[model samples]
Target chain A: MIQAVVILFSVLAIGGALALLLTRNVLYSAFFLLLTLLGVAALFVLSSADFLAVAQIMIYVGGVLVLIVFGVMLTHKTDPLNRSNQKPNAVLTNHRAWLWPVLLAGSMFAVLFQMLRQGNFVLLNRAAKYQTTVDTIGRQLMAEYLVPFEIAGVLLLVALVGAAYLAMPERN
Target chain B: METSTILIVAALLFSIGLAVVVVKRHAIVVLMGVELMLNAANLNLVAFSQYDPDRLQGQMMTLFVLVVAAAEAAVALAIVLQVYRHYRTVQLDEVNDLNN
Candidate 1:
């Protein structure tokens, strides 16, 4: 049952990512990213990191995806007439320089897959002891991980301020 | 599903993300690719956390990663907006003022 769910979401994630990569229209790519983020969130749930899964949805899907869409809308030069005309080629791109990235990512995956498939990786049995992660995460965030947690808070504040400053319109 | 299976899926996702970052010309699309890559790393951390179970260090790191990724995305998009303002275009190849 869980395995089926994992397979389903993984397919969703990978397939959506592929679509995101191949899509020409910047708006379409942003929408596809939302699909990919949701799939990753589901994958998190399947892995029993319930807290992480929720965070993924809230942060990635809710926050980041919206920001990306806003960037797309703000940056892309839109045409009201073209909108009505609906030309198929909204944003055409040349793929002539794809060889390097394909070779780089492909070789990296091949090496990692070969290593993982060698049966040398150590994996502990977590299902027997699996429990609600929220409590554990809460405690750790307050105790052992307190410093980093605080730092992350400060970082987020800085990012918030910085984004507002950067995106603000110029003064007269 | 085996741990190896999960890892392989992550690898595939990460590679596709790399491809997107490399191939895409639009800054926003490249940002999406970076997000995909970050999610792949987060998946690996969570999967390994499942294995350890004792410290749950991987889960903690994943939380930090989520925060950092959000921060990165926010700043990156801001920069993209600024780029668009300066260049009047978002195509990375065309925004080549630094090349000369």
Candidate 2:
């Protein structure tokens, strides 16, 4: 049963990424990214990382996806001469459609596949049991990972302020 | 739910993201590719953490990675918006000039 779920979610994730690659419309790609993020969250739950799964959905879907969609809508191009270009959001580039992307990414996959085929990690052989990791994660973040946790907060604050500043119309 | 199976899924995802980054011309699409790549890495970290009996170090690292990816998306999109404002287009290939 778990195996079936793993396969299903993996397919969903990979298929979503593939759809994002194939689509020309940026807005549609943003929605496809939503699919990918949701699938990854399911995979996290399957892996017994329930806390991370929730965090994934909240941060990626809630925060980042919204920001990306805004980026899409706000950055619509205005092509005056090309009246035929109906979709101003359309990104029409007719170069390197197949060769380099296939070669680079395909080669990297082949390498990782070969490496994993030989991996025999003893601990990883057992099935992961579902355990509530929120308490443990919270404790760790407050205890052992405290410095990094605080730093992450600082980084996020800086990013928020910087993004607002950069996106401000008054700057231009 | 074999570890190798999960790893293979991540590898596939990373590749797809890489392909998207390479082939897509839209700046936002490229950013989507980057997010997919980060998600694949997070999956790897979580999968490895499943077996860690001590501190769940892999998952903790994944948390930090999530933080970084969020920061990256914000900055990148802001830059993309700036690119659109100046170049009047977000088709990356068209913005190849040094100074305009």
List DockQ for all candidates: 0.70, 0.73
List TM-score per model, in order. 0.92, 0.93
lDDT per residue for candidate 2 within A26-129, as digits (tens), equals 77888889999999999999888999999999999999999988888888854667667455445443335699889999999999998888777777767667
State the lDDT of candidate 1 residue by residue for A63-109, as single tens digits.
98888878877786655566755455365434437789889989988
Per-residue error at B42 for model 1, in Å? 0.4
**Candidate 2, residue A38: how far the Cα is off, in Å:** 0.6
Best by TM-score: 2
Off by over 4 Å in 2: A78-95, A170-172
For model 2, the docking class works out as medium
TM-score of the A-chain for all models? 0.87, 0.89
